[model samples]
Target chain A: MAAPAILITAFVVIGGMATALAQSLGLFPLVGPPSLTVAAYAAQASDLPVGIGLSLAIAAASTVVACLVGFTAALVIVQGRWCGKLVAALGTLTVPVPHIVGAASVSLLLADSGLLARLFNAGGSWPELVGGPWWIGVVAEYGWKESAFVALVVTGTLATRAVSYDETAALLGAGRLSRLRHVLLPLSLPTLTVSATIIFVYSLGSYEVAWLLGRAYPEPLPVMALRLFNAATLTARPEAAAVAIVTTLLSFGAVAAALAYLRRSTLWR
Target chain B: MIPAVRVEGLSKSFPGTGAPVLDDVNLTVEARSCTALLGPSGAGKSTLLRAISGLERPDAGRVLVGGQDMAGVGPEHRGMAMVQQRPLLFPHLNVLDNVAFAGTVRGVAKRAARADAAGFLELVQLAGFGPRPVAALSGGQAQRVAIARALAARPAVLLLDEPFSALDPELRSVMHDLLAQLRRSVNPTVLMVTHDRSEAAAVAEKIALFSGGRMLQHDSVERMYSRPVSLEASRLMGGANEIPGTVRNGCHHSALGALRLPGDTTWPPGPGILLVRQESIEVGPGNGPGLHATVSGLRVLGPRRLVSVDAAGVLLRAEIPWGRALAAGDTVTLSIPTSALAVVDDPDTAHTFPGAEKRPQITVQGLATLASIDN
Candidate 1:
């Protein structure tokens, strides 16, 4: 039963990638005889470096912020009183909202003349948060949306075995801080790492949030690829495929590193 | 010196329960003593242990360690350590680090704490096993490490909750001996909870019997066996036969026949329960001049034979040497010495022999009358 699904998925993904690779190597030209060349990679060499750096910075920042907030939310949901239920409900509510809708909502909320700035009557001095040089609005959109995902996954991990382990630590003479440091943190590390990897790869490849909230000078890799893929000139298509291939490789590398780290964790066994 | 631990008037009830799980319970353990809380499942033995260890807060009473009330104190601040049924070792840490955890939490240097932990491992006979991962240890070895971890804290009191229930019988015996040796060398006041009476008797100096959320009796192991205070306590302490009888003029009359009571007996003329240990009864040929009984069943248990006999219409169980060629359908004579009988007022009519048709109906008034006979 699973074999058919696996085969279909693998075929679609690998077929799509093979087509992109052929176009990226100048072997599947739209208007001329196909010839293998590295011109597509050379054409975007200057801007590709900038796009990669900007993408890494944004994904890394968003993932770090999301993980910190999400982990705290998970702890609260697992160990807290009445307020924990409220936080858990809010996280569940946030998870199903599409990223495109999230980006539009963030754009409306954080733009210079948006609701908050208008409410405070500080439109002239709203700090340029939306479409700013630092891409704060883009990072905030990803962080807000992905934090909920992290929280739900982590809550599931902790709900299984954390209470008994925490009680054992308490009986073993571990105080609140000691229990958190020795038991909860170490036990949650593998799940946290896995969730963080998902968040990093998701933010790296996502297009709508960055395009909706980011400045034009240093576009993220996904936005840059989309722009090149839609250009009027036909030669830019191969460059777009080249950028997509690089982004896929980076995401794969991150997932591999995370899996290796998870294997080495004592909690994995 | 002050007692190592004291629990006074402890009572706790869950939200939906009608009666309290722990009801006005009190217990004490002297310095350098080992006490076992013995009871059946759901008898609140473990709840009492947790309440004393500061893991559960009592509604009406307080726990005292070294005469210091532990109200509002956390388990860590109460200077007590507990070993649970599962070893509960922190899986992220090696055996040495897990054993050294309490010391490190108390702010001892890691190196010194590890050295102390090594000594504890040696005490548990796992000397070179310090660096092994906790997952690699067998069930018995993991529990041994748990004991070492509890001891490494040098706690004022130690609590164990059925710590050996998961091990095999042979490993359980080995753990019992290890605990006994550790008690001699370290001398920490210990309270262990177990449903197995033999396990409690083997490891503890004193045993506290509990049933239905109430402590029935607390006494030395010898006294708990030879002189249980109540019929319920007598049954819990392994009394196999209960004979209902009436006391009259310094003699006790029962289905087993009239027997002279001890001269010091204070039991007034009243209905009471006579408890007989299974081993105290001897079986012989039915032709002898004694209580004539027909063998109902015989079970060979290692070096002994458990023989069940029916005397007249009363069923009695006896344990005899395996050399006796006894089988079902054989006629036998049973002998019971009066000195081996422990008589007390029948607490309730819940348990009684089948042939005793004239047994008195238990009433509140009758219980009160029997209670007065003791004074």
Candidate 2:
């Protein structure tokens, strides 16, 4: 049981250190012969400012939105009698619909001349709901997809905490909102933090939605990285590897921060 | 004002669960009175407390706090606070804030809430400890803080769910005394739920015994110990020496010789339980036929010796004073002080002392059947 976890952690540490060192020394077989260079590192760092900015913005926005959805879904499922069916429905749908399937389904549902256009157009020309005639398509895809992910993780966690803490708070004369704010929020922090960060990091690296929805000028980090990785002829491969390394680094950093947060937070205690 | 709480015909059954956890359960907690709800684990004392505090909605019953029906009123509105088995202090808040939570929720200003919370800190003897984090308080100190918090709300009814059972004996007594002081000072119509019979007897103005799912008896603590309504209640209240026999004519006879029974209006006597507490029986100098008993085992429990003996092939256990010395296998005369005979009517529920059917002779038995040992 412990072996796989130990092995996986060893792989992550060894893999991450090697990748970092290689990227530093410019030992890319695809790009060129083994060579140490400060220029490649400098360019990578300068590119990272913008990439990391977009990356952090998406992470923060998605995580906050997801935490709210999760908290709300949990409250409804725990306190409301009818929310069990919703949970059942969400649970059943979550497993079969892979990420690619979800991205495709969402796009199919929301794209112009798609189901949404049919609903709104009524024999009129397709409104600029997709293809970014305005900033509508990017916002629509990001909101819809991340919100679903948030609700999915939060529903289970919130339900358990709501049930556990609600009765106890009730006995102690804590009202619904007060209990949620004090007891539920603190007690469910470890799970909620982990869940939101999971959604946030996944959203940052998620390629399917960004590729299908975002345009070239303001391409999402992952999709832009994919574009950069493929078009590399020979010398640009190291730069591409550098972008991959940055994305991977972002995921690790977010997870590390969340773990640190969980340690300092009282819920686990 | 109809007492702080009056629960009548309070019955409830969950969807799939057939029997009601609380079945026609009735109890009244007078203002300024501390009543301990006593029962075995599934006895529904805690459930009853929840219903009174308006946590669990009772199916076919009414809970009125201070003459106001608490049908739709929330727990906060009812002025009822419960201290659970665990301290359940908020880690985010320092000691003052956690205790002040109830007052703040009741619309008190933050400064006033902290001031009021500080008042209880002194009351629970935690005055110097307010500014510290809640995590720093010890279990016993935290429990007192929880009590102080409950009292800070100035609740009309305070429900305690085995609040001190988690503490050691010394701390439990300290907490108990503190509770007694709180009840006297504030008169908040306290209701405590506990399975400890001794605790119930010690702390409650009245003790209600629950068994299986039904409340067997709810009476004053003295009455509950001295004259429990049923066999199970008596057994729960610690009636250790119960024996099976019959009543013939006017004399009550048993596996032991017949003695006089008392007049009891509760049960119409006919083959009933001869209940006696271990401390009630006095062991004296003998071999002169006080049921012809022989000691089997003896344990010296400071100031009290728990002497296990056998009489007439039936096993009886008694707790005698330190001065009353007897060894294993020693024959001694065990006298059932006439004041201690509590006759319960159902023999199947307990041991039937012979001749308890007609007249009123209470023949005390020795060690009961080993079968009743596990019970």
lDDT of 2 by residue, A59-111 (tens): 57656765676566656655657665685467446645566666576667767
lDDT for every model? Answer: 0.86, 0.71
- What candidate 1 gets wrong by more than 4 Å, as runs, is A118-123, B1-3, B261-265, B285-292, B329-331, B347-375
All DockQ scores: 0.69, 0.38
Candidate 2 Cα errors over 4 Å, as ranges: A1-57, A79-82, A122-129, A133-161, A232-235, A242-264, B1-3, B15-18, B243-272, B287-302, B308-317, B328-331, B351-375
What docking tier does model 1 reach? medium
- Write one digit per residue (lDDT tens) for candidate 1, span A1-269: 79999999999999999999999999899879999998999999999989999999999999998998998899999976788899999999999999999989988888997878888899488988888888999889999999999889999999988887887778778899998898888988998999999999999998989998999878899999999999999889999999999999999999999999988887786
Alpha-carbon TM-score of each model against the true structure: 0.92, 0.83
Q: Lowest summed-lDDT stretch of 10 residues in model 2 chain B?
A: B353-362
Candidate 2 global lDDT: 0.71
Cα lDDT of model 1 by residue, B63-116, tens digit: 888989999998887777899999989888999999999889888999999999
